[model samples]
Target: MIDYQLDADGLATLTWNVADRPMNVLNQASIAAFTKAVERAISDPSVKGVIVTSSRPEFVAGGDLDLIRNIRDVAQSMDCSGPVSRILRRLETSKKPFVAAVNGSALGGGLEICLACHYRIVADDPNIQLGLPEVTIGLLPAAGGTQRLPRMIGIKKALPYLLEGRKADPAKAFEAGIVDAVVPSSELLSRARAWLLSAPAEAAIKPWDRKDFRFPGGSPQSPGPIQIFFGASGALLAKTQGNYPAQEAILACVYDGCQVDIDSGLKIEQRQFARLAISQSTKNMIRVLFYDMNDANRLAGRPKDVPKRSFKKVAILGAGMMGAGLAHVASTAGLEVVLLDVSGDAAEKGKAYGAAILEGQVARGRIDESVRDATLGRVIPTTNYSDLADCDLVIEAVFEDRAIKAEVTRKAEAAMRVDAIFASNTSTLPIGGLATVSKRPARFVGMHFFSPAEKMPLVEIIRGAGTSEETIAEALDFARRIRKTPIVVNDCPSFYANRAFAMYPYEAMTMLAEGVNPNLIENAGRKAGMPMPPLALIDEVSVELLYKAMKQARADQGSSYCAQPQDAVLIAMVEQFGRLGRKAGRGFYDYPSDGERKLWTGLTEHFPRAEKQPSVEEVHERLMYSQSLEAARCVGEGIVSVRDADIGSLLGWGFPSFLGGVLGQIDTVGLPQMITVCDRLAQHMPERYAVPQILRDMAASGRTFH
Candidate 1:
């Protein structure tokens, strides 16, 4: 995989281009080839220095995750990480200057390799990111990243990149001393060669390898670093809530490694990496966040018979928050967007929302003023239905009411091309029911974008009974174009993500009605790795919205409706106390203009605390199992596939990635163990804790979701 060539000046150039793969990744086969190339260059008498670069778009994507995913023991973990570490160490300490000519993004093992070289010079491209981001996928940078990065920069500077898995573009990387220089793509190779040729023999030695080298920041024993370590530990625990072991492991690697010699520090890093490699958390993350997520993004569930389609123009009906956000994303993706509402003024206000966001991006230096102006210029705000006539797709982000949605659907369809697709951005209403109003039911579909569509990554593409394969293909294509992960589901109430996620907040309210302490309930949710505590999430989403949805469901189902225990709590909060939500600045928590929100003291007056409280573990399990059980029911009912269920849970509702997704949590907890927990929970609330038959069958058959 390594193409080795010697120049007239005795400079050896090793160009990495793995023939089979699009990007050069560090794997057994490629590592072995690279080792041979390094050995040949070092042993050859004619070679004076070496330059490493890649012919692919990316220098190296990272380690082969397939190999890391299969690592089952410490020995396998060491074997997976050790060889590359050894090879890189040899390259850096061989007394031969090596320069890394980074042409594109270099992350994890890719950045680790760059750190090993005597000097790193990257192409001056904003898209080129360089960082050690292994912690994000549940492992530390095993191949000498933890050791070398801290030495190259400092402990304080390196900790954020290593712990949080932050990436820096070419300019930021140069400012942070992660790379020596940044040059144009065309001059990358020549610049690397020039640095190698002009460097003295002493330049071959790394700072840490020299006996007199001192760390840029103080050592671990110094007051500043010790204080940083203290603060970082507390911050890590607070941020992670102790759900992720990888962060703790990374903190230990840097703190423990940097105090000793480079070789000893590397061994410390490898040992920690081996422990995390075979961790259950690591496996779950790699499976759901990596593998399953990749499957969803690639449109794995799309009908194979239909060819891929593209959208040139899309019209969004209603210029509220959701509609405006849709316009922003579509226009940003280079599609002409018609953002329409009832009046011209309303539509113009919606367009201003996108403009404000673009202005912020320009101020942050994230985008140039030219790019901002061009992107905003593509969104045409108007009240005319005739504007959608030439559009390939029209998505209505109107009111959740069926009559209002049906009205917009009929109007948009009347003004659009015959073959163009019509989509409703409804999260709860059944897509098939909504399609009944359309003259062309085959073209009617649901494209459910979460609130603040520009930020949320998920788009649940609901396939109605009469929806054509071509319509589904086009919907998936539009989701991809806007950079959202689309999960296709058969039509049903609340759909997959909302149906499964609703249980989370409902269970918390159930406990509140049972006299469980509100603080305890919120803490348990956060401790379980939920992005927001149940009460806080409810407040943010607005309790008024929840009450309305509950009332609507009751009206629709009539006598067949099954009222949850939380219904009483919702009624008392909204009707009895008139505490609408955060929007009203009065809900479960009392928001102040001058201070951070605190739990309303009147909560206990209404829902008094019980004399005895449940353990935190019990509360945590109740919250986790409630959501996973509903996800299992979705799978059993054939509403969603197993992979989509997991991916949707993650990207849709912020189900903890470290636990995988909801289904991944079930698999990790073991089918039998999950059933056992559910059975125990069912003793209290049978309806809420009812286990799906799919879990039992999988437990009996020894099957896993992954």
Candidate 2:
């Protein structure tokens, strides 16, 4: 309902409160209500000023995303422009000052609504963000925003915001001309009233409509903007690699809107926005990055229902790369950390890792010198177990040996408080076995931080059979506190990601044995959207680790490890030839500090390049699909943590983020088709490429991986 109240000062306050919703959103009902309220304020001579506010936590969130998602017909979507722009035009034309008081977030159409008003005053709530982020979701501002925002802020500044689709902080919003002022929550209404009272109680057409308004970089009569439109179109295609459609749609809307009158411009916007909203890229982006991602992070599978996780000090038990990175992140998050190792020098080396990273961040302007110093100061290094006595959590990121891990677990358990959590960073060892070494097994769990923990986001929290609910919740909370995405997984081989991911390198190494050029196989991996090809990935992992993983696979899989043609080749290289890997400057590739990484040319005589060029498609499938099929089997066999399996793949390994997750990629490409491709290729791929039962079931039921 369009309810309006006018005070004796001739100031009319129109409040929007959508029933059964926490935030105000623009939809047909709200738009209709807005039109009615605006008409009332315009017709009443008693109303000298109009105040638009929300009676909810958020001033205005945006348009209903579900409504946008259903807009498949571009022409029908275009029709929405007529009434929307008409109301905005009418409100602008009303001979009364219109001011918006944003009590919370003002985003998308919400921000567009504020742009239609004369001025905006926003609450300074830290939770509040203000911007037009339509581009990121595969759409653009359609309700006269493309036309108005640029007119207010100038083209260059507005273009970056529209293209990138980032929500700005309140202060940033004010500075960027998206909002005029920011006020604290308690004084939001009074500050808004003061501004409204001081503003001239009259309205005029916007500065853009003035006869003398000249768009910067272009005269209204010139071809300058035309050059920009064509230039920007090319740049968008180049940067996005034609992988996204939002940038093109945004550019098209703005270019057309700028040259036309406001009435006709709205039509162009609605049409482009609709087409973009339904494009494959946009649909996939919203499903993966927004909906499913939110679902993954919010899941609570454990019994804890723990209210809070308290940990003021953290102790890391190993001074290796993973342990040092854990110390860095913990200290940076305002937790006092003690880095301990077997000896004093080892502990000192771990502290150096934190110092090196922080110093570089300071140099790059990512963190100030004081912040860097503060972070480094929080991480105290020592070899003494006494230093870990008061620590609330002790994480051991050591080798994968079961014996070593069990020993470390006992030591960590003994050093910390009885209630403190002891986490093992062992990727492949049985967490249950390690927990058995602890007296308080309920307080022990697995906090598997991927190598280079500071950079990687996902932390796989493995719940040991005896781990307490409180321990799991506290570990998950600790991961979040350090700005990481954490997923809870039942302990099993590889947990989820690395276990399935190790298959790719094995497949690539197998291909190398079949006379495929090592570089060609690696190049195919990269073209398939992997950050590194298998050989390069193996080098980064070190040759000794790959050999150990292969050995483990052989022992576990038995018949599943039935030798493919290339398995014999890697086995011979690692066992018979004594050519370990990058350490020896040889393996599948050669490396020296100063030279370009190239395949060992001499090995070409030993393993010749294949006479036939396998299509990049064929090569990518053999390498990537083998791992995906194994991942499906792992999921079916309860080796993976369900619900978040795909996100785990991306963060644990470099599974492509654009594909959403591994299963999401399968769904996007059609799981049935993927299964068919894998099955057909299995003839030559041995056990690695064989389609798993899960894929077969999904194919039969026509179900997606999600």
Best model per lDDT: 1
lDDT of 1 by residue, 1-706 (tens): 9999999999999999988876889899999999999999999989999999999999998999989999999999889999999999999999999999999899998998899999999999998989888888898998899899988899899999999899999999999999999999999989998998899999999999998998888888899999999999999899999989999998898889988998999999999999999999999998887888888888887888887887899999999999999999999999999999999999999999999999999999889999999999999999999999999999999998999998898889889999899999998999999999999999999999998888999999999999998899889988998899999999999999999999999999999999999999999999999999999999999999999999999988999999889999999999999998999999999999999999999999999999999999999998889999999999999999988998898888899998889988987888888899899989989998878888888888999887
lDDT against the true structure, each candidate = 0.92, 0.77
Residue-level lDDT of model 2, residues 115-166, one tens digit each, is 9988888888767888888776667887877878877776666787788877
Compared with the true structure, the alpha-carbon lDDT of candidate 2 equals 0.77
In model 1, pairs of residues that clash are none
Misplaced by over 4 Å in model 1 are none
Counting clashing residue pairs in each candidate, in order, gives 0, 0
Candidate 1 has an lDDT of 0.92
**TM-score of each model, paired residue for residue:** 0.99, 0.84
- The ten-residue window of minimal lDDT in model 1 covers 301-310
What local lDDT does model 2 show for residue 672?
A: 69
